[model samples]
Target: MRFIDSHCHLDFDELADNLTKYMSDALASGITQFVVPGISLAQSKSLLAFSQKHPSCHISFGLHPYFLTAHSRDEMALLADLAEQNSEQLVAIGECGIDSQCDDLELQQALFKSHIVLANRLGLPMIVHHRQSHHLIAQAFKQTPPQFGGVIHAFSGSLQQAQYYLKLGFKLGLGGTITYPRAKKTREVVSRLPLSSFVLETDAPSMPVFGFQGQINVPVRLIDIFAQVCQLRNESEDEIAQALYATSCRVFSI
Candidate 1:
């Protein structure tokens, strides 16, 4: 089956330790492409070197909300400059979004808005890192919609929430969460949402699949996630694979 892992952190310690091996494993599993998101200014800059080495891995640079302490007051300006300087080498403008559980929700929203504006200006899509702040995210999107559209990475929301993102031209990212038997809501959303409104992601070295919990996740687990998605949907494996590949390509224009 053809697949593209729309989100993966190949620069992270666990995966980057022996990236060549993991990359080989992913390629052998029929996964064609991988999108690596920027979690901070330093990490994003670090990714530049990785991109030069791995042409098959695409990059997107932005600050993640969870690491707000790593960001400075002029962080958005710096991120904008970095994004512009390496615009040609990047695919989207994320892993940025607000997480309600964090105390700095307001600050995260401000940064997210800046990210939205930057993405719109660059005509690039986004790889939004959403959590328990769907209303906040949807509100941000509704206020300043993304012109190139993006994916809600590691999506785990209701069908109504899923429809909201789909309506705004964004696609829901299906990851390891759906593999669990306890993910009934996410599974139900997967089973119900239109095939075109989704993309596959591993968020690797992070979101390990069901049986592999506590292990370092990798892009190859995308195949297992894809298998679960096929079971959740009515489409055949080939049909699901083709549609998901097309959606992944379209979302990032990679």
Candidate 2:
């Protein structure tokens, strides 16, 4: 079964070194495509360089809520320019969204809005990052629905929230979160979610699978996540794989 890691941080130093080795292993393990998201303008530059080096790696440009202070108006403008300049190279408009845990909620909301607007203008999808702020994201969707749709990466939200995003034309990104036994709610949601509403991701160097928690995440682990997904759902391996592959392709316009 072929797969795509809908989210990963291949530009991070930990993964960047010997990236070729990791990419080789991931390809061997059946993960054929990857989407690397940007949190800062600098990271986006590095990500673009990496994407240029690797044909299978696609990129998304956006400012993460956690790094809100790191970038200013100029950087935001730079991101928009980069998106416009590299329209064909970009797959989405984010890794951007509200994180309730962060300070300056108002600022985060404004930044997120800009990202959504840019995405809509660019006619590209987005890769949203949500943590304790589904209501804010839902509210934004109500105000201005995604023009090209998007994905809620590393989603561990309730089925109700999943349905809300699905209603807004967003796909749920399933990753290592489903591998943990304590994630009963998310696992159950995954079990029943429509295949079309789901996409696979590893969030490499971050959301490691249950047993490999301390280890740095790599795209090759997409296979193990897929194993857990298979256990939770009724679909056959080939069916699940094909659906996920098509969903990623459709959402990102790859």
Candidate 3:
């Protein structure tokens, strides 16, 4: 079945330099679409250029928490402007959310809240990124729920957390994390969750699946991730593939 990588970093030089080749690889593997989230304003500029050139690539504009220090107030204003100016080109508002591992949870929260507001105002969804901060993200949502809920990028958590996001209208991104034997909880969550609540992603050049640890992840590996997902659930491979493709389209309005 055809698939969409809910998140990828094609703007990163490693992927962008050989984009045509990798896009070919992804297409060959049945992955026809990709969603690229913005981390830094600088990188986002390049992402926009790439999206313009490649019709299969979709994008969002927001700041990533890990690089919080680089995002100034002016940069944030500019981020909003970018989202607005490119509203026609954008599918979502992020790659932005809380990462408990990062310093200054308060700053991250503020920026994330701003992204939520920006997304709401722009009438688009968001691509949320989280690490050990489901509570924090849920808390943020309590304050202002997503007007158009989006995808939780690279989701790995308990069924409760997965349910929480799905209740708020977000889809959980199933990535290489599920390929690991050690990820029992997440795999179980995947098995138990509704088939429609899930979407596929590789988080390429990072989050390499099972046997390929330490190697750069690529879009083509979505097939392998899809394989692992099929093993976790009760659905047939073709059934799961159709459901995933349809749900991904619903998520990003693809």
TM-score of each: 0.97, 0.97, 0.97
Q: Candidate 3, which segments miss by more than 4 Å at Cα?
A: none
lDDT of each: 0.89, 0.89, 0.89
Per-residue lDDT over 50-80 for candidate 3, one digit per residue giving the tens place of the 0 to 100 score: 8888889999888999887844557888989
Q: For candidate 2, lDDT tens digit of each residue in 1-254?
A: 78999999887888867888999999998888999998988888777778878889899898988888845557888999988998888989988999998888888887888899999999999999999898998888778778788899899889998998898788999999999999999998999889898999999989999999799999999999999999998989999999999999999988
**Alpha carbon deviation, residue 73, candidate 2 (Å):** 3.1
Q: List residue ranges in candidate 1 displaced over 4 A.
A: none
> In model 1, how many backbone clashes occur?
0
- Give the TM-score (vs. native) of candidate 3: 0.97
RMSD (CA, Å), candidate 3 to true, equals 1.1
Cα deviation in Å at residue 138, candidate 2? 1.1
Task: Give the clashing pairs for model 1.
Answer: none
Residue 52 lDDT, candidate 3, scale 0-100: 80
